[model samples]
Target chain A: MSAAETTPQRIAGRGAAPQRSLWHVILVRPETMTLVLLVLAVILASQLSPFFLDISYILRSFTLSAEFAIVALVLTMVIIAGEIDLSPAANMALSTCLFAWAQASGVPMPIAIAIGLVAGLAMGALNAFMVIGLQLPSIIVTIGTLTLYRGLAQIIAGDKSIRMPEWFIGIDKVLVFGVPATVAIFVVVSLVLGLILAGTIFGRQIYQIGTNEVAARYAGIRTRRIKLILFLLMGLAAAIAGMLTASRLGSVRYDLGLGGELQMVLMAMLGGTYIFGGRGTILGTFLAAWLLVVVSTGMTVANLLPAIQLTVLGVLLIVAIIATNLIYSRAQR
Target chain B: MNALGRILARRETGIAVMIVLFALAVSLYKPQFLTLNSLRVILLLTPLVMIAAMGQMLVLVARHVDLSIGSMLGLSAMLTGMMFRDLPEIPWGLGFAVSIGIGTLLGLVNGALVTFFRLPSIIVTLGTLNLYRGLTFIVSNARQVDRQFIPADLKGMSQTSPLLGIPWIIFMAFAVALLTYWFAMHTRVGRQIFALGSNPIAAPLRGVKVTQVTLLVFAISGALSGLAGIMYASRWGFVNPSNTGFGFEFQVIAAVVIGGVSINGGVGSVLGVMLGVLLMGCVAAALPLLGIPGTAQSAIYGAVILVALLIDRSVRRQGIARFKAARA
Candidate 1:
C-alpha cells in the first residue's frame, strides 16, 4: 500500500497558484534550510577545535561516511517514490561477506565482485517482489529482510572478518583533485541522482506516485514498475557501497556498516526529505552529508565521547523531520 | 453451529498446531527434544520476549509501532542496574517502579512527539531508539552492570520456582499477559484503542479520545518494556550498555506478527501472541539440539516474520473474499 493511505496527512494536487517571490521560492525550501545548517555546523565545529578547520582532515573524515552517503543518494529517490528500504545496510554486510568469502575461497576477484553485485541485485529483487508483487508494505518488508540479510551474513562470516586481497584495499586512499575516491564518488553520484530527480520524467512520476498512488496509477504512471526499478537501484547502490566499505576496511564482517541505516536515513531526513515521502531533494542530502561529517568529525577532534555524538545525531534526525514537515505543510498552502 | 466452527478455526489454533508440529518434528530427529528439560529450556527463553511482545502487541494494534522498545529496555535496565550498584541500601523492589517509571516517561516523550507534532510513530521511535541507547551509554559511562551489583534475590527469580517448577519470571510474564487481556477486553479504553486504530479519522468523530488513547498505548508499551528491562537483569544477572535489549524490537515484533497481529492494525489476540512467543522459544531451544549454530537463530526469526506476514496476508484476503461472497 502507498504511504498516503497509512499516514493521515496527504498533500493533494497543487491547490492554487499564488504569486510567489523569487526569494520565497529559494529561501523557503528545505534545501535552503539544509544549506544554512551546513554553514552553521561548519562554523560551530570550527569553534569546537582548531584541527576541525583542516580541509584534508574533513575530506578524510567525509570518506568514512561516503559509502553511506552514496547509498543515501539512491535512498532519497526511493523515499521520494513513497517507499523505504531499511535492509540496505544489512544488504551491504551480506553482499560484502559473500564477496570476501568468494575471493578468499580462491574465486577470481572479478567473479567475486560480480557475485557480490548480483547478490545485491537479487536481494533488491526480493524486496521488490514482496513490495510490488506481493503488495506488502515496504517498511515492514524491508525490516524483515534487514534482519534476514544481517542474520545470513552472520551465519556466513560467523563473527570472523574475511580479509580482502592486498591490491583491492584502500579505495579511499586514492585521491583525485585533493578528494578521496569514495568522497568523489559520493559527489558525482549525488549530482547525477539530483539531475535524475529534478530533470527527468521518471523522477517526476516518482513524486506523483508518492503524492497519491491511486491517482498516479489511474493517470497511467506504472507506479508498481517504477517502484520496482527504484528498489532495484537501491539494491545496486547498496552493493557498490558494500564493496567500497570492504575496500576501505580491507576486510568484510557481518557487522560491517552496522547501524549505517540510521546514518543514511539521517542524511535523507536532515536534507529535508519528508519522512512520509513525495518531497525532498538530492542537494539537501548532499549538503546534509557534509554537515554530518563536520559535526561528527568535530566531535571526534574535540575528544567528545561517541555517545554524545550519537545523541546529537538522534536529536538532529527528530528535529530535521519536524522542521521539514513544517516547511512542506506551509509551502503547500 | 457454522459460526461457532469458524470461531474455533482461528489464527491461534493455527499457531498452536504449528508449535506442536514443530516440536514433534524436532523430537523425531532428537528424542531428547521431547523431554521436560527441553520444555524448561524453551520456557526459560521466552519470559523476556513474552513480556515485551504484550506491549508491542498493544502498540501494533494501535496502528503505531515503537521501534525504540529495545533501547527503552536498555536504558531502563541500565539505570536500574546503576541504582543497585551505587545505592546499595535501597530496597530491590524499587527497581521495578524506577525502571518502569523511566520507561513510561520515555514512552510519553515518544507519544507526545507523535501526537502533538503529528510525526509518524515509526520514525519517531527509530529516532529515539538511538537517542535512548546513546543516553544509556552516557549514563553508564559505557560500563556494564556486573553480576555482583544485581541483587541475588532478583536473579533467584529466574531459578527459584514457587509452583510447578516454573520460575517467578515466567509467572510474571503470564500475569502481564493476563493483565493485558483484561485491559484490552474489559476496559472501555482498550476498545477505544481498537476504534482508534481501525480508523483514526472516524475515531475522533466517534469521541474516541485520540490523543489520550494514543498516549495510553505508548505508555503501556513503555511500562511493560520497563518491566521487561528489570526482568532482563533478573534473567541474565547483568546489563551491558551496548548488549542489553539490543535488536529486541525485532524478536518482539516477530513474535507479535507471527501471532497474527495485523500490521495494518486493530487486530490481535493475547492468546495468539503468547503462542507466538512460545513458538519462538521452541525454535531457539531447538537450534542447539539440532546442531545449528546460534548465528542461524536470527535468520530463522527473520524468515519466520516474513512467512508469518505472508500467512497473515493470505488469511486476510480469504476473509475479505468470504465477506464479499456472504454479502452477495
Candidate 2:
C-alpha cells in the first residue's frame, strides 16, 4: 500500500504501519483539532459566567440551538455526499409558515402539521429535480432556491406572526429526564445519523459519491438517486426543525430563522467537515454544536452586543474551515 | 434577414425579447406603465444594481463568486456617511474616493484569503460578508446616518439630470459599464481574466497570471460595490448599517446570471449584463403598477434566477452539441 493509504489504516488500529506514531494521529486528525477547540471554548465559557457550569443552564441554552443542531446532522451527510443545500433555513421558514397558516385558517392541528411536512418534502423534491435531474451546480442552484423559498415565506406570512395552539407551544419547556424535548430529539437524531454515516453501505456510497461522483457512477453507484434521497432527507429534517422552532417560540413568522443559513453552515464547517466534500462525521458536528452553543452563550453572558457576536461567528467560520482544510491537506501528504 | 438572425442568435437577444414581452404584458394591463415617467422610474431604479452587476459579471467570469459585495457596500456606505456626518467641511466628492478605497482594501482581503490559503471564494466571501457587515455596525455604533447629515450635492446626483432628464447616478453607472466594456474587450489583463476563468489549470501554462487576475476581479467587484453604496446615500439620502445593502448581492447575481454570464466562467458581456439589470428593473417597476406587493418582489427575483439558469444550461448544451458536430 501507498504511505498515505497505510497511515489511515494504521490509525484505525487494524494494522501496524511502522512509520505511524501517536502524535501523527493526534495532530493530523481534523476531529482532534475540533476536540481541542471545543475544550478550550468550554473552559473559556465557564470562566465567563459562574452559571455556565450548571447543567440546567446549559440545557436551557442548548434548547435555543437544538433545532439547528438536528438539521446540521443531515447537512453533514449532504456535504459528505458532495452536494450542499443552502436553502434549509429557508425551508424551515416556509414549511413552518405553511403549517401555522393552515392551522390559523382553522385546519386541524395534525393535518396542518402534515401539510407542513409535505411542503418541506416538496421543496426538497424541487431542489433534487433541479440539482440532480437538470445537472446544475448545487451551490448556485440552492442559492437561487434559498432566495425563492424565503421570498415565498414572506409572501405567505406577510409580516404577520401566526400563533400556534396553546398546548403546542414551548417544546423547550417540555423535559424528559431533565432534558428539553428538543435537545432529546437532537441527541437521538444525531446518534442515528452518526451510526448510518459511519457503519452502513448506503452511508459508504455517500462518501464515494462525494469524493468523486464520476468514479462513483462508474462503480455502479446510483449517484443521482442517492443525492436525490439525501436532498429529500434534508428537506424533511428542516421541516421538523421548523416545527420545533415554532413550538419553542410560540409563533411562526416569515423570518422565523432569518439569517440562519449562516449558523447552519457554520456548524457543519466547525465540525471539521471538508468543504469540498467526501469527508466529515456526525460525531464531530455533534460536538461542534455544543461548542457553538457554549461560545455564543458565553458571549451573551458577557454582555457583548449581537453585532459582536455576528463578527465572532464569521471569524470562527473562517478559522474553522482554514484549520480543517490544512489538517486534511496535511493528512493527504 | 441574415443580420437579424445573427442578432437574434446572441444570448442578449433572448433577454431583450423577454423584457419586451414583459413590458408589453404589463402595459397592456396598465397602459400608463408605458409612459415616459414610468420608464424613468425603471431607469432610476436600475443604476445601483447595474453598477454592481458589472463587477459581479467579471468575478463570475473569473470562476469565483463574491458574496461579500453586499456587506462591502454596507461598510463603505456607512463609512462615507460617517465622514459626511462628522467632517461636514470635507468635499462630498472625497466620499467616493474613500468608499472605493475601503472597498478595494476589503476586496483584497478576500483575494488574499482565497489565494494565499487556497480556500473557496464562496465560503471566504460568506464569512467576510458577515464580518464586514458586523464591522459596519461596530464602527458606526449601530447608528444610522440621518438625512440631515448627508450633503445636498451628494443627494443631488439622484435628483439632478444633465441629459435626457436622467439622474447623474444613471450616467455614472453607464460610464462604469462603458469602462468595463473597454477593459474586457481591449486590455491584455482583461483577456487574461477570461483565460483564468475558462480554464484555471491551462491558464498558468499559457502564461496567465492567475493570482493577479483573480485579485483584480475581486478588487473590482469590491470597488464597484463601494460605488453602489455611495450611490445608495444619493438615492435614499441616508445610510443604515444593516439596511443599506441588505440582499443586494442576490439582485446583482440574479441580473448577472440573467445576462447570460455563464456561472461556469469565461463568458459574459457588458451589454448583456446591462440588459439583464434593465429587465429586472422593469419587472420591479411593473410590480407596484400591477398591485403586486413588495413581498413578492424577492420571490420574482429568485424565480428569475432559476429560469435563467435553465436557459443558460440548455443554451450551453446546444452549443456543445454543435461544436461536437462541427468537430465530427
Candidate 3:
C-alpha cells in the first residue's frame, strides 16, 4: 500500500477536466463541511438562547471540555498513525487518582504531580508494549487497559472524592489574557500540535505508517519506535488533561471523566478523521470541540435532559462517521 | 513445534486446570471453600453470563463484536419489567418472548447498520450502546421496576430447581450453549461465518452471503442478550433503568476471550466458553472466602482480561513461528 491508496482522491469527470475553481475545492473537502456545520451549530445555538452568542460565555463553557479537546489533538495524530488509545479517559482517572492519592498521603504537590505523569507514562508504555511489542490489536488491548485503569482508580479512591487544596483548585478561574487558563492551554496545544502534524517530516511519517505499516517498515520508517513514542505522548497528554480536569473540578474521584472516551472519539470522528486511519487535521478537531461544546450547552440551556443529550451524542457519532466515510470513498472514486 | 502443539492441546485443559488449582488454593485457605453449597453459588452466579457468552462467541467468531449487548439487555429487561408492572393479569411466561423479541429487533438494527451502511461494528455498537441505554431510560421514565412489581413466578425461577439443586434457569443457559455448539459445528452457514472471518475477501468469492451471515450472528447475539435480560429480572426480582445489564458486555467478552475464543475471530468452541464462564464463576465465589474486598473484584476481572490477552498473543506467536518453520 502507498500514500495514494489511503489519501482521498476526487472523482473528476471522465472527459477533459473543467476549469479549476476555488469553490469546487472548498465544497468537496470534509474540513469545509465541518466548518459549515460548526457555523450552523453556532447559529442554531444562538437562536436557541440569546445568551449563547456571548463570546465570554462560550469560552467559559469551553473550559468544561477543554481538557478533552486538548487531548483530542494528540489523539488526531495517533489516529492518523493507524492506532487508537481508548484507555486515555481511564488513564486520566487513574493518573488523577494517583496524583490526588499521593497528595493526600503527604507527598509534596510537585512530587505528586510527577508521580502522576510517570504513572501515566508507564501506562502508555504498557499499552505500547502489548500493541507494538507483542503485536496485539489496539482495540481489545485498550479496552482491557481501560478496565484495568478505571478499576485501579476505584481501588485507590474507594468511592471518595479527594478535594484539592484551595490554591490548586480552579485552573479555569485562572484566566490568561482574559481567556480561561484551560481554554488558553487548549488553543496553545492545538496550534503547536497542528503545526507539527501539518509541517513536519515526522508527521508525514505518521501518515505513511498508517497508510501501510508493513510498507512503511520496509521503507525503513522505524514504525514500532514511532508508534511507541506516539503512545507515550498519548499518556503524557492524558496526564496533563487529568490534572487540568482535577484543577477545574477542584476534586478528583474514581469516576472522574467516566464515559469521556465517547466524547473524545466523537470529536475526532466529527472532525473528519478517517476511522481506518491515515487522514485528519487538528484544525478540524479544534473546530469540532467548540461545535460540540456549543451544541451541548445549547441543549443544556434549553433544558434537555442529560439522557436525551446522550442520545444526541450517540446519533451524532454514527452520522458523523457515516458522512466522513462517504466523503472519503467518493473522493477516492 | 512441540511447545506450540502443547499450548494448542492445553487450551481447554489449561482452563480446567486453572479452575481446579484456583479452587484448591481457595479451599486450602478456608477449609469450607470447597463444598456443595459453594458449587451451587458458582452455578447460580454463572448462568446469565454463560448464556450471553454463547451469543458473544458467535459474534467474535465472525470477526465483529457487539458492545451494545449490555444496553440491549437493559432495554429488553426494562421493557419486560414494564409489562409485568402494568399487566399483572397476563401470564409471566410471555415475558421471554417479549424480551427476546425486543432484543432481536435491536440486534437487527445493529446488523443493518454494519451490513448495509458498512460501518465498523465496534463504533456502531458503541454508539448503539449509549443510544439503547438512553432509550431504556426514556421508556422507563428513569424509574426502576420495583421488587413487588416483578411477577412471583419470575423470581421463583431462581429458587425452584427442576432436578436436584439445579434451577431451570441453569438448564436454560446450558441448553443455549448446546444449541450454539450444534449450530456452529454442524451447520454450513455457521461454518461460513468462520470462513468469512478467516479470509473475508475469499469468502465472497467462495459463495458466502456475507451480509446475511453477519446479520444472523448479530441477531443471535441480541436475542441471547435479551434472554439474559429477562433472566436478570428473574434472578434479581427488579430492573433499574441505569443499573440493569450495566457493564454486562465486559463480563461476557472476558469469559469468551478466556475460553480461547480468539479475538481475531474464525476460531472458538462451546466447551471453551463454558469452562471460561466456570473459571470466572469460581473466582467470584472464592473472593469472599479469601477475604478480598469486593472492590478488588472489578480490578481482578480487568487484570484477568489483560493476562489472558498476553497468554493468547504468546501462543499465537509460537503457532506462527511453527508455521513459518514448516514452510521453510
Candidate 4:
C-alpha cells in the first residue's frame, strides 16, 4: 500500500520521470494557456474599440474588480487544498454591513473596523468547524453559509444603505505610483501568495492534502489544521476585500458585492484551478484576473448591454473549466 | 403493529410529525394560524416551491444537483411572458409547451456539458445559472412583462378554485407531486437513477445507462422548473427578468434537505419532500404573523438547511451503527 502511494510521487519528483522537451513543458501548462488567453483578450478588446489599448484606462478599470482578484488569490489556495468557500462574497456583505452599521450608530472607527474583521473571522471559524469538525462536505457547507451570511446581512441592513465617513471612501482613487491602491494591493497579495504557494514546504503539503487526504495524514501532515488556517485566511481576505469595496463605493449595503462570488470563482477557474482540487497557482489566477478585466472592459467600452456581458461571462466560465480540464488531462499523458 | 412501526420509523413520518409540531407551536402564538384561511395561505405560498422541490429531489436522489433550476425557471417564464406580450393571438395553453420545452432544452445543455466533458454538475450548472439569467435579460431587453400582458384565464389559475376553495394552482402542484411520486417509485428508469446514484462505478456493471439517467434527471428538473415558471406567471400575474426566480434554488434545496433527502444521495421520498415544502410554507406564513420582518425569511431558510444537514449526518451515523450491531 505504501509503495503504491509513493510511486506516483516518486515519478513526479524529477529524477524518475521520463525526459520531456522544453516546448512540451512550457506549452502544456495551464498557466501558459491563461497567459495566452490574457494576450488574446487584450487583442480582442483593442479590436473591439479604438480606445481599448490605453494602458491608463485599463488600469483604472482593473480597480473595479481588484478586491475580487485579491480574494481569488486566497481562493486559489483553498481550491488547491481541495475545499471551497462560496460564502466569501456573502462574508464581504455581512462584514461590511456590520462595519458601516457600527460606525453609523456612533461606534469609533477603529472598533467598527475590528468588529467587521472579527465577524469575518468568526464566519470562517464556523465554516472550519462545520467542515473539519463535523466532516461535512465543504461545497454544501459553504453554500449553506453563503445563504446564511447574505440573509443575515439583509436582516441587518434592511434595504437601506449606510454611508461611510467621507475620509474613509475612495481607496480606489488613492494612487500608488500611478496605480490604484486597490490594484496595488491585489498585485502585492498575488506576489506574496504566489511565492508561498510555489516556494514553501507548507505549499507542497497543501497539494498533498488535496491529492489524497488519507495519504497526507499518513505522511504526518496536519491536514485539519492546514484546512482550518486556509478557511480563516479566506474569511480575513473576504473582510479586507469588503472594506475595500466599502471604501470604493463610500457606502455599505446588504447587497454590497452581491453576485461577486461568480467573478471570484471565474477568476480562479480561468486560472486553471482544478475544481476537484490539488492543481492551481496564484500566477495563473493573477493573469486570469487581467484577462477578465480586459474582456468585461471591452464589452463595456463597446456599449454592449450588461445582459450580453453576463452571457459572455457564463460562457467563459464553462469554456475555461473545460479547456483547463482538457489541458490537465493531456499534460498527465 | 409491525407495519405501523415500520411506517412510523420512516423519514416521511418524522417530517410529518415535525410539520404538525411546528404548526402547533406557531398556532400557540397566533391561533389564526390553525384556521382554514391560513391553511389556504400556506398552500398558496408553497405551490411553486413544492413543484421545484420535486424536481430537486430527483436530482439529489441521483447524486447530483441542479443549481441552474432558478435560472431555467426565470428564462422559461420570461420567454412565455414575452410570447404572451408579442403574440397575444396565440392560445394561452400553448404557453405551457413553450415554457416546459425551453426548460427541457436548457436542462439538456447542462446535462450534455456534464456528461460529455465529464465536468462536475455543480460548476456546470453554476455557469448555466448565469448564462440562462443573462439570456432572460437579453430576451426581455431587461423589461418586465406587466400584469396586463398575462392572460386572464392564466391568472385565474391562482384565484379560481375547483374544490374546497383551494386555488387550481394548489391542485396542480399536488398533481405534479403525485405524478413525481409515481414516476420515482414505479418506473424502470426511476429505479435506475437510484441505482446509479447509490454507486456510480458499480452501476455500469449492473447495466445502468449512466449518461441517459443523468441527462434524464437534469431534464426532469428543468422541465419541472419550467412548469413552476408558468405557475409563477399565473400566481404573481407578471414575470420580471431578475425577480421571477431569484434565489429559488436555495428555497427548493432547503425544503428538499429538510424533507430528509440525503445530500449523499440514493435515499429520499416524495412524501417527505412534500411535507418539507409544507414546513417551509408554514414558517414563511408564520413569520409575518409572528411580527418577524420579511427580511428574516432568507436567514431562516439558510439556517434550516444547515440544521437539516446536521440532522441528516446524525441519522446516517445511527443507521450505520445499527447495521453494525445487527451484523454482530
Candidate 5:
C-alpha cells in the first residue's frame, strides 16, 4: 500500500531517481548491511596493516568465521523454530575432547570420528527430549546443557590439552593449496544447509514451526517431529564445527569454547536472524559471518583491541536488531 | 477451605517444612551449625539476597526478566569502589545513597526498552548483558581497589552489629524485606502489578499504567542490587572483573523459580524468596561441611535447581488442575 502511495510522490518528483527499487530487501538485511560495512573495513584494514590481507592471516581468521558460519546456519534454523541450542559450542568442545582423548588412547581415527558424531546426536536428543517432552523453555534448557556439556569437557581433559598425533595433524592440514581443509568443509556444509533451509518442504515446515507452533500443529505439520529433526541437525552441525576447530588447532581444551555459544548467537543475530524467530535466511547468516571476520580484521588495522571490537559488536547488535525491525515494519507497509 | 487461605497455607507450610528439615539436617551434620554464630551467618546471608530477589520477583511476576542485574551489580560495585577511593571523606550514608541512584538509572533503561520496543526482554538483556558487562570491564580494566581505599568508617557500618547481636547489614536487609512485603501486599501499585501479571491486556484496559509500573519495578530492582553490591564489597574486601558477582544474576533467578515464582510472570512472594535464598545460602555453606569435594558448588546447585523445577512444574500443573476442577 505504501509502495502504491509512494509511486505518485515519486512521479511528482519528490525524491531523486526513479524510486523503483529493484534491490532485494533480503540483501539489505541488517546483517548484510553490516557485511557491506565489513567489506569497507577490510579495504581500510588492508591499507593500514599489510598483514591484514596476507593469505595466511586471512586463512587463519576466515576459517574460524567459516566454521562458526556453518553452525550458525543450523542454529539459525533452530532459533527460527522458536528454540535455540546453546549447547553446540559446549557440545563441540566436549566432542572434540572426546575424539582427541579416544585417539590418544589408541582408538582408530574413524571410530573416534564416529564417537564424536554419536556424542553430538545423543546430546541433541537430550535437548530435544526436554524441550518436547518435559515442555521446558528451550533457553533455560540450553543454558543447563551449556553448563553440563562444558563441565564434561573439563572432566574429560581436566585442564590439560590433548594434542593430535601425526595422523590427526595430517587431517588438520589444508587439502587444497594449503588453504586449510576445515575451511573447505565449512563452505560445503554452509552451502548444503543453506539449500535445505531455503528450498525444501521440510524447510518450509521449519518456518511454520517458528511462526506459530500451534497453528502448524493445527495444519497437521507434525511440529514435534520436525523440531526433533531440526535439533538433531543443529547437533550435527556443532559436531562438524567441533571437528573442524579441533582439527585446526591440533589440540583440545575444555575452555576452548568457553563463551563462544553466546558469541555465535550474537553473530547469527547480527547476521539478520530475527531474535523472536521465523524471519531470517541462512545466506544472510553466512554473509554476516564474513562480516564479523572482516570487522575483526578491520579493527586490527585501526589498532583497536578485541575489547573495543567486542563492545562495538555489542552496540552493533543492538542497533542492527532495532534497525532491522524498523526496516522490516516499514517494508511490510 | 477457601482459595486464598489454601495458597497462603501451602506457601507458609512449605517454608516451615523446609526450614525445619534444613535446620535438622545441618544440626545432624555439624552440630555447631545450630549455634547462634553459625546461625548468624545463615540469617545474614538470606535477607540481602531476599532484598535483591524481591524486585527480581516483581519484574518476573510481571513476565519480564533483567539479565542486566549482573551488569548493574558490576556497575554498582565499580561506582561504589570509585566513590570510596575518590571521596574518602564523604559520609557513609550519602555514598551509599549515590550508589543506589546510579543503579536506578541503569535499570530504568532496561525497563524502558523492554516495555516500549515491544522487544522480547530476553534478547534485550542478552545484548545489554554484554553491553553492561563490557562497560564495567572498560571502566575498571585491570584495576583493583583494596580495603584500604575505602573509608574505614564507612566500611565499619557494613560490619557493625546492632540488632540484638545481628549485623546491621542483616537488620537492614530484613527491614528492606519487610518494606517490600508490605509494599507488595498492601499497596495499590502492588495490586496493579498483580493485575498486569495475571493478564497484561486486561490490566491496561482496566486503567493500570503499565509503563509506569514497569519502570518503578525496574528502579526498585536496581536499587536493591546496588545495596547488595556494597554489601558484597565489604564481605569480599576486593573486586575484579573476572569473578565479581558473576553468577549472581542466574542464581537469583534460579532461586526465585525454585521458590515457586512462576517464570511466566506473576505469583510469588518476598517471604518465599527469603526462604529460597536461605535454601541457596545453606547449600553453599553446607556443602563444605558435608565434605563435598572441590569448590564447584555450581554442580550441586544445578542439580538442586533441576529437581526443584521438576517438582515445581508438577505442583503448578496440579494447582491449575485443581483450579479448573473447582471452577467446574
Candidate 6:
C-alpha cells in the first residue's frame, strides 16, 4: 500500500508514463484562465481603439471602477464570512444625499463626511441586529432593507439634487503618479486586502466561519463578531465610494450609486466567488473590476453603442457565473 | 399536507371575511362602489393580475423569486405592440399565443439559472430584471403605439359585460385562479414544490425532480406576466416605455408575499396571492379616485406591503409557538 501510494497512479494508456505531481493536476485555476482572457480582451480592446491607450482615458476609467472595486473588496469579506448587504448601494445613495444636505445646511465638510459614514455604520449595525436577532436569512433581510433605505433616500432627496462643494468633488481627481486618487485608492486597498486575506488569522477565521458556521463555532471562533465586523467593513467601503462619487460629480444626487448593487454583484460573481459563501479574494474581484472598466472604456473609446457594451457585460456575467459553478463542482469531486 | 390544508383553510376563511368587510366598508363610503359599473371595472382588472399572481405565487412557493416579471411583461407587450400596430389584421387569439410563447421563453431563462446554475434565484432574476428592462429600452427607444392602430376586438373585452354585468376579465381571472389552486393541490409536482420549499435537500433525496419543477414554475410565471402585459397594453391602448409597467413588478411581488406567502419560500397559496393583489389594486384605484396625493399614493403602496408582511409574520409566529407547544 505504501509503495502504491508513493508511486504515482498511472493511467492504463499505452504511452510513456506521464510525469506528474498533485501540483500539476491542480495547475489549472479559473482565476488564471480569466487572467488570460482578460489579457486577450485588453489586447483586442486596444486594437479596436487607439484612444483606449491614452493614459488620461485609462486613468479616468479606473477611477470610475475604483468605487465598485473597493466595495467589492469589502463585500468579499462579507460573503466569505457568510452574509450580504444588498442595501449598500441604497445606503451609499442615502448617505451621500444626507452628507450633501447637511453640508448645504452649513455643516463642515469633515463633520458631513463623519456623519455620512456613521449612517452606513448604523445601517450595518441595524442589519446585523435584524439578521442575528430575528434569525432571518440575510438575502431576504437585506432585500427588505434595500427597499427601505432607497425609500428613505428618496424622501431625503425629495426629487431634488443635493449639491456638494467643489472641494469634495475634486478629492478623488487629484493625481498621484499621474493617475487619479480614486484609482490609487482601489489598487492600494486591494493589495492590502490580499495580504490580509492570505496572511492573517482573522482572515482564516473568516474563511472558517464561512465554510461551516457550526464547525467554526466548535473550533472556538466568534462567528457572529466576525460577521458584524464584515458588515461594518462593507458599510465603510460603501461610504468611502459614495464620498468619492459625490466628490467626483461635485454634487450628490438621489441616485448617487443607483443600480450599483447590480454592478457589484456581477463583478464579485465574475471574480469566481461562491454565492453561498466561504470562497473569494480581493485580487480576483480587482481583476474583475479591471476587466469590466476596460471593456466599458474600450467600447466607448471605440464609439460602440453603449447598449452592446451592457449586453456584453450581461453575457459575461452569466458565462462567468455558470462556468464558476461548473468548475467549483468539478473541483469538489 | 395537513399543515398546508390548515393554512389554506385558515387563509381562505380569513380572506373571505375580510373581503366582505372591505366591500361593506367601501359601499358605506360610496354607494356607487357597490354598483354594477364599479364592480364590472374591478372584474375587468382582476383576470390579468390573477393569472400573474398565480404564476408569481408558484415561484415564491418553490423558494425562488423572479424580479424580472415587469421585463417579462414588457417583452411580451412589445412583441404584441408591434403586432397590434403593424399586424392589426392578425387574430387576437394569435396575440395570446405569441405572448405565451414569449413569456415561456423568458421564464425558461430564469428557470435554467435557478436550477442549473445553482445560483440564488433572486440574483439571477435581479440580473435578468435589468437585462430585460435594458432590452426593452433598446427595443422601445421612445417608441409609442398609436391608439388608432389598436385592435378594437381586444379592447372590447376590457369594457364588455358578459354575465351579470360582469366583465369577461374577472371570470377569466377567477378561472385562472381556480385552475392554479386545483393544480397546486392535486398535481404530483405541486406537492413536490411544497416538499422542496420546506426542505429542498430532503425532497430531492426523496425523488422529487426539483429542478424541473422549479424551472416550470418560473416559466409559468413568465407566461403569466406576459399575459398581464398584453392585457395592460390592450386596455390602455398604448405602451409608454418610461411609465408603463416600470414599477409594477415590485407591486406584484409585494402583494404575493404580504398575502401570506412566506418570504422564505414554500408556504404561499394562490388564494392568498389573489386576495393580496385585489386588496392592493383596490387600494391603488380607490385611494386615487378618492383624491389622494400622488406621492402619498406611492408611499401608501410600500406601507401597505410592509403592514401586510408584518401581519403575516405575526400570525406565523403565533402559529409556530402554538405548534411547538403542541409538540411539547
Per residue, candidate 4 scores C-alpha lDDT tens digits across A1-333 of: 344687788677746557889999888988999899888888888888867788889999999999999999999999999998889999999999998999999999999999999999999999999999999888878888999999999999999999999999999999999999999999999988998889998988889998999999999999999999999999999999999999999989899998888899999999999998989999999999999999999889889999889899999999999999999877765
Q: Write one digit per residue (lDDT tens) for candidate 5, span B102-198.
A: 7788788778877777666767776776676677677776476677876666566567776577666777777888998899889999988888887
Off by over 4 Å in 1: A1-17, B1-4
TM-score of predicted model 4?
A: 0.97
RMSD in angstroms between candidate 2 and the native structure over all alpha carbons: 3.4
Instruction: Judging by lDDT against the true structure, name the best candidate.
Output: 4
Q: Which ten residues in a row have the lowest lDDT in candidate 3 chain A?
A: A6-15
Interface RMSD of each: 3.3, 3.3, 2.7, 3.0, 3.8, 4.8
Cα displacement (angstroms), candidate 5, residue A146, comes to 3.1
DockQ result, candidate 2:
0.55
lDDT of 5 by residue, A1-333 (tens): 344577787666644543446566546556556667667876887887878778677766777666666777888898888887777888888788888889889899999999988888888888898788788777766766776677677777877899987555544456566676766766676788779888998888888888898999999999999999988887777887887777767788977766576568866777677777777777767777777777776776687655566567667666767776775665544
* Per-residue lDDT value at B57 in model 3: 92
User: How far is B230's C-alpha from truth in model 5 (Å)?
Assistant: 1.8
Tens digits of per-residue lDDT for model 3 on A1-333? Answer: 232453444223423355657887668777877899989988998898888889999998899999998888888888989998888999999999999999989999999999999999999999999999988888888888888898899999998999999999999998899999999999999898889888998988999998899899999999999999999999999999999999999999998888888889889989988888898889889988988999999999999888888888888989988999998876654
**A1-333 per-residue lDDT for model 6 (tens digits):** 333463454423324545566874455455655677678878888898775667687778788767877898888778777787677887788777777888899988889889989988887886787666556667766766666666677777777787777556686669989878989888899889888887899988988888999999999998888888888777778877888888887877776787788788877877777777888777778788887888888878777655555556666767777777787765543
Candidate 2 chain B, which ten residues in sequence have the lowest lDDT sum?
B203-212
TM-score, chain B, predicted structure 5: 0.92
List runs of model 5 lying over 4 Å from the truth.
A1-28, A50-56, A65-67, A93-116, A151-178, A247-253, B2-9, B15-37, B44-48
Give lDDT tens digits, candidate 4, residues B257-277. Answer: 999998888888898999999
For candidate 5 chain A, the 10 contiguous residues with the lowest summed lDDT are: A13-22
Global fold similarity of model 5 (TM-score): 0.88
Consecutive 10-residue window with the lowest summed lDDT within model 1 chain B? B1-10
lDDT of 3 at B300: 72
Which CAPRI tier for candidate 6? acceptable
- In candidate 2, the residue pairs with backbone N, CA or C atoms under 3 Å apart (3 or more residues apart, or in different chains) clash, namely none
Tens digit of per-residue lDDT, candidate 2, span A230-284? 9999999999999999999999999988878888888999999999999999988
In order, what DockQ does each candidate have?
A: 0.56, 0.55, 0.55, 0.56, 0.33, 0.27
lDDT of 1 by residue, A192-293 (tens): 989988999998999999888999999999998999899899889999999999999998999999989999999999998888888899999999999999
**Stretch of 10 with least lDDT, candidate 4 chain A:** A1-10
